[model samples]
Target: MDTLLSIFDVKLAIENLPFVLSGLPMTIAVAFLSMGVGALLGLFLALGRGSSYRLLRWPTRIYISFMRGTPILVFLYVLYLGLPEVGIELTAFQAAVIGFGLNSAAYIAEINRASLNSIDTGQWEAATTLGIPYWRTLGGIILPQAARIAIPPLTNVFLDLTKATSLAAVITVPEMFQKAQIVSGRSFDSLTMYITVALIYWPLCIVISAFQERLEKRFSRYVNE
Candidate 1:
């Protein structure tokens, strides 16, 4: 019982609550900013991958492959440490955002591509039959349908991105995990600080997932109609 109880210290965790919570804003900011950057780049890459032109298609494919293939930690190191060797310097926050954003974009691009492909061919046929421009058909009709289809997966990706921000602590970005580390080091209560951090992440993911489910159900109704 002593060993089991020692595994977690609820009292210490509660005591450190305010200190760990202080990092919440920075964590949210990193996640939001990274995902925003990812969405734009991912959308662009998805369009490029779908293009018939070899120039656009080949490079986009290669980029997606490389980004997806590389580990996130390596990419973060490349941004935070490697870039400085090339005469480019960025603060920890900037590096975290850029690194995480670029990594998230590759996954997001694939998600967008799959969603875009899932769209009904008949919709494209009807648009083409009506003499709608390719870009207009894609932007106005196809994308809306794809967006609904993509929401659930995209929300999962966002949740993943939010958790990935913890890796920023490695580069000294002072996110939630970093704060927990600082508090734990000073308090000598690793288990409590870690549990507190996990608690924080658990709820954020739960909320995002709950919202995703609601959106998915709403979109399904549109499909059924």
Candidate 2:
């Protein structure tokens, strides 16, 4: 109790707060940026993953397999460090964002594919009866439903990305973990510094989880009622 309370001292940590908060914008920016990129790429990946034709599916499968199979650390290292050796230099932040975004795309693709599949087959048939084009029917009828199913897992991915941002520390992105390291170095209080960072992480995730629940309830209304 004492240790926890000690770490939560707003007054003592007040000066430290701005430094921590400074990194937050970047953290959140990278998170949202990555999610946006991941979602766009993932949409295609999901489509390809569920594609009926082998020609279309194989390439997508290979990309997903390669990304999902590799460690994120290894991916980052290759992009940020190794690529420079091959004369393809990238900024650490850019490399980290791309690496993590690409990885998240693989997982998001599977989530989207699963969610797309979860929609009732009759929903598609109903759209067919309306003489809607396939793409139009998907946009107008199917996607909204799939989005609801996907939201919970997508939020789960958000939480994961939030935590994974810590990996940016390894590459000196000046994010929360990096700030913690700097403060810990100065205060020689690594324990307190990290505990505070952990506290911030926990609450953000809890909020995401709460919002996910609310969204699910709202979307389920057409059926539950």
lDDT scores for all predictions? Answer: 0.91, 0.85
**CA deviation > 4 Å runs, candidate 2:** 1-14, 221-225
> Model 2: number of clashes?
0
The per-candidate count of clashes, in order, stands at 0, 0
Per-residue lDDT over 1-225 for candidate 2, one digit per residue giving the tens place of the 0 to 100 score: 987676565554666867877788778777878888888899899999999999889999999999999999888889989998989999878987898899999999999999999989898898889888999988877887888889988988888997898898888787888898898899877777787788778887898789889988888864564
| Candidate 1 segments exceeding 4 Å error | none
TM-scores, all candidates, are 0.93, 0.88
Clashing residue pairs for model 2: none
Question: lDDT score, residue 33, model 1?
Answer: 97
Q: In lDDT terms, which candidate is top?
A: 1
